[model samples]
Target: MFGGVTIGEFARLTHLSVRTLRRYHESGLLAPATVDPDSGYRYYTADQIPTAQVIHQLRELDVPLADVAKILATEDAEERAGLAGEHLRRLEAELARTRAAVLSLRRLLRPHDDTLRVELRKIAARTVAGIEDVVAQDDVLSWYDEAMAELDAAIESRPLGPPGGRYANELFTDGRGTVLVYRPVADPPVRGRVHPVHLPPSELAVVVHPGPHDDIGVTYGRLGAWVVDHALAVDGPVHETYLVGPRDTPDPAAWRTEIGWPVFRLAVTDVMPGKNPGQTGNPPP
Candidate 1:
């Protein structure tokens, strides 16, 4: 007998409801100290207060019930520490996602009254020496890292400029795509996927995207719409030239990518002003 405090009295003392206490009993996490068989009532002792408080704190932190039971049952300090640490890491990741979303929302709320600048320019032919791969869209990031690492390993000298570029083509409409990575250099290796692919000189509608690659799609969409608004049409797949990719630049905000949509110049004004042909621009609010 926990100094003979009934379930109702224990709930009041612990700031927990009687229903919650019954649930704890059913889950066997915080069982009552005594049971009155004749009345089918549960009673808790004052001595059980510590255990009840621990359960309450864990629940407040949104710990899983099973995990709370495991923590309470485990006598080893190291195991409990590891469990808590793992949960903390998960919580931190969730916080990071929330923060990113909030920042994106703030950008969206700002005025878009000013017309986005779009210019047509001829890109000169350039030689880029780097590893290339036909990577699936889902595995593109890993493929990018691996290709860059391979280039780094085989190179006698690193590219004298920014990390370089990724050329993407719509191989599969839904989720699959092929992307090629190229770095500016005089000569590249002959083995593996490392072969010379000439980038033809073309007139491109260019927009500078300064931020993480995660949100470049938003910029792409906006630029595409701007091009359409000006009566232009993209005639080919888009190109992304990373002037400051992750390997070369650590800060995401410092990363600059020139998002280019190859276009055929047009003079028609009949195209709808608000229609977004390339939903790649600043992310949807």
Candidate 2:
């Protein structure tokens, strides 16, 4: 038999609104202890107060109603704790993503009075320990992290140069293509998805992108514009030189990356000669 206390009393005890309690009752999440046969009034007991309070807390954390029901219905305390823990992990992941978005937004909305300096460099062909795979655009960051970790483990000696990557043009235009990450090392060996790659000499229009990679797209956009305005584009994979990165510094402000776009040279830049045209360090503001 169901015990008796008015639904309003249960709502007050739980600090939940009467309307919320009614919705929960209709959804079969928190059924009242009793219902009057004639008046159709709902009833609850003092024992139901804790269950209502638990449900309220779970809802406040934005747990799905079905998951909330499981947490409530489970009789074993350990089982309930496990259910709560799973949602806790999910909540933490969401909070991290939200914080990253806020940081990126702040950088994007702020005014940039500085010009992105672009350099013309001709890199010589070299052999290095590398990994290459076809990957989707969304998976680049995760893939790079895994590949770099593997590279670090496989190579024991000091690196000849900083780590770098080549992102095929199709990867950006078509959303998926080849990605290669490497560390320049002398006499690199072939081992478990890591092998020696002979990179061909090529010319690049390079720009240094500063800070965390969250707003890196902005720098990319600026650099691409410079390339289009100043030189003939070469159909080659885009290169990124990790100068000062997460592996080198914990502070995001100190991170510096060189974004290099492969290009064919024009005899003269597509610039209007109103002043000194030799100034290539900083492009048009």
Who wins the lDDT comparison? Answer: 2
Q: What 10-residue stretch in candidate 2 is worst by lDDT?
A: 276-285
lDDT of each: 0.73, 0.86
Tens-digit lDDT track of model 2 for 1-285 = 446878787777888889999999987899887898988889998888888888888899999999998888899999889999999988987886787678767766888645678887889999999999999998898899999999999998899989999999899899999999999998787889999999999888899989887678778877787777664566599999999999998999999999998887664444544646557652331
Winning candidate number (TM-score): 2
Model 2 CA deviation exceeding 4 Å by range: 1-14, 33-112, 274-278, 282-285
Q: Report model 2's TM-score to 2 decimal places.
A: 0.77
TM-score of model 1 vs. true structure = 0.63
| Model 1 lDDT tens row, 72-185 | 898898998788777778787687667767766766678875555555668887766656656667677678888877766665656656555545556335556557677666
> Which runs in model 1 stand beyond 4 Å of their true positions?
1-25, 28-102, 131-136, 167-173, 191-193, 268-285
Indicate the residue-level lDDT of 138 in model 2.
82
Query: What are the TM-scores, per candidate, against the unseen true structure?
Result: 0.63, 0.77
